[model samples]
Target: MEQTIPPAESSIVEFKREWTETARETFCAFLNSHGGRVYFGVSDDSSIVGIDKPDEISRTVHSIFKFAIHPSAESYVQTETLKIKDKNVVMVTVLEGSEPPYYVTIKDNNKKGRVCYIRQGSSSYEANDKEIRSLYRKGNPIPYEQRASANQNLTFLTLAEYFKKSNVQFNEGKYQTLGLKDLNGFFTNVGLWLSDQCTAETRVGFFLGNTKASESDGIFTFSGCIIEQFCKIRDLLRNRFGFKNKIEPYTLSSEGYRNEIADYPELAIREALINLFAHRDYSFENAQATVTSFSNRLEFLSFGGLPQGVTKEMMLLGISIPRNKTLADILMRLSAMERYGIGIPTIFASYENFSVKPALVCAHEYIKLDLPRLQQIPSDLTERERAIVSYLKQNGASSRKQLQDFVKVSYGTVINTLRSLEAKKIVVKQGAGRDTKYALTISLR
Candidate 1:
């Protein structure tokens, strides 16, 4: 009897005379695109070439799916035996994978590489970046932080130390749990952010006036481990914008008190900083988070505007859909942030008693939080009253003679300014006779 002939090769069916390493590429291609079948022991020209060891071929095919395809494509594939022309052959069928694009690992010249394959016509071809992105968009969209990084050789010493301080286990065994590595044991993009050799840039700029064009008082660039960068940025902000202590002398019936007032509420600043780090889009390599300090306000800007299905109103209402889930998870585990999605609300609430409200502006590519500085001194105060208030803010309580020396005015001019401030209840007169001094009564609220 003439041997049974297989159908001609097509997009949905492939034939191989024998098992070869390239077979794994075709398997990946099938899984990434539409499902297809590969018939081992069959010639490309639809001729049956029976397998010498059917059982062995089946076992080898199973092994190839197990170790060669990324993200475990074996679950979507199956292998069996068929008898054609009274001879046995191996048949491998791959179903379209739900999560793609699947990649196959190749080894050549003592080096290993990964390539995503897609079925084009009747052949498998390496997918370009655009094709891969389309596949991701069609399937479950993969978070950039969850994708494997190009640099496989990575070290997480900084991350390990951070976890150690937090008493969280961060050894090799917990890499998958922490999202440092994928199922295939490759370093992921999240791991790159936490690595000691991270190259992502984050910047903080202090302008002399109120805009970017103004002379930069200072600029700080942060790189490497993200945790360390957070700490450093926090410290820098604290030093530049922290609160100052103002003493209120005792009155006839009330005891003396001290108040700590800051340019911007410290809690609001911290929440904005944490939100900037947690929700930023890591996929935009050129974009970065920036803290621009102006004379009257501080602006926190980060790339990758609000997440999908989230809006500025939703954020104000305490709704959060994190752009980078793994990064946010790690931050939550470290206790650096809470999962309640209240960071923005907390920032707004911090300024509820203040005259100026915090503003949130979202655009296509970036989001910004503007925090207005505390202005306890009345905006309508006279120039001399403003001068006196500024002087007292810097020098604390001051005698009339000292105020005169500081403001470069006569004692009478100083006394008139002080009396006007006192009349407005913006200044408090302390002590008696020559020991008298004036202090600001500007309430923090």
Candidate 2:
């Protein structure tokens, strides 16, 4: 069906006095937003002003769309040299594009960058990175995993084993069915990732302290099959971390000698790693999924933050809009992912009864989670400092008066102790003024 393009300058229409370079932005805006039309011979006031050399102007319009726009936007746009009020006007009709984030690429002045624009009333507005991501969300018909892989020759030894264990027969037919390779025999990004020939990096670093300035205890990187990488990373993390620091082990059986402990819960760590593999943006191949361990915390960072329309609070509530549904499905069947939506909740649940819960944060290019270490009481603290720590741990948040009474110290002494504890990162003061209360910090150290 043909669109009834309005002539007056508006959100979906633009008027240009000539075949000017500035029309590039308007064309880009139309491609990114809804489809719109531009009148080459029309003035900004919507008056029909005839243009000379209509044929030349049409060629120029075609040239601009072909060479000036990124991703080759010529197919989504059309031009018609028509007569309006006896004046020659070139009407360039642009259609809504399937592959969006359209932008003008200017080679002038050696400047390098894209200038994406969205349609505003009677004008075009520049779009930011977040808006560009939203455009990808709207127009991406093929998932990153389903796209054709650069490497056609690939092998999947570990992937085959996982499939065999799951009782899903592995063969060429299964490859097509699982979307590892297409009917045309081209391997997809999914096949590339699971194959032994995979080149993506997942870097893990164990640091002595909370920042990079501290000496790194150990470092390892993987660039093979995703499943094999997961196994190796799991083993390394278990060997380096999965034992109690200062906390005592819990009784595992009726026998008094049966005790077990881990500084970080296994389930939480498992879910975090799985989430990193299944949800990280594979399209952004340059960005590596990273695991950095500090003495105080464990951090997981993945490419591309929460998917479009998903909020931090929504993710916390176990709502998952997977960026790679096909990859997630394959991993889920292989038992790498227990199921959708359980990863975040299970991690939070594992931290229950602890002073600090895991921190989940979203950014434009990545999402990060900081898992604080379990609380450990230092032995060098003054009696009053230790009392405040114990009291806050037991009673949760407390006022200054409550701490003063519980510690059996002078009012001034209680204030000093609370301040000292706050400085030690053991206690966090909450609220202000008359409603002030102090509670144990989620002990990063």
lDDT of 1 by residue, 216-292 (tens): 65688999988878877876776555343222221111322223356788889888988888888776677778999
Predicted candidate 2 versus true structure: per-residue lDDT over 1-445, tens digit per residue: 3323364788888888887767878888999999898888888777777788888977877887888888788888788988777778888899987788887875446535678888878798788766886797688866778888999999888888878888877877788888898768899998999898988889999765457765565688888888778867866665444333222222222331312235587788889998898888876767789999865688999988877678888888888888777778888777778878889999999999888889988997799988876644564576567556545643457899999997788989999888888888788889999999998776522
Residue 190 local lDDT, model 2:
87
Error of 1 at 267 (Å): 1.6
Give the top-scoring candidate (lDDT).
1
**TM-scores, each model vs. reference:** 0.55, 0.67
Q: Give lDDT: candidate 2, residue 383.
A: 52
Error of 2 at 8 (Å): 10
- Give stretches of model 1 more than 4 Å off: 1-140, 243-260, 376-445
- Name the weakest run of 10 consecutive residues (lDDT summed) in model 2: 250-259
Candidate 1 weakest lDDT stretch, 10 residues: 246-255
lDDT of the structure predicted as candidate 1:
0.79
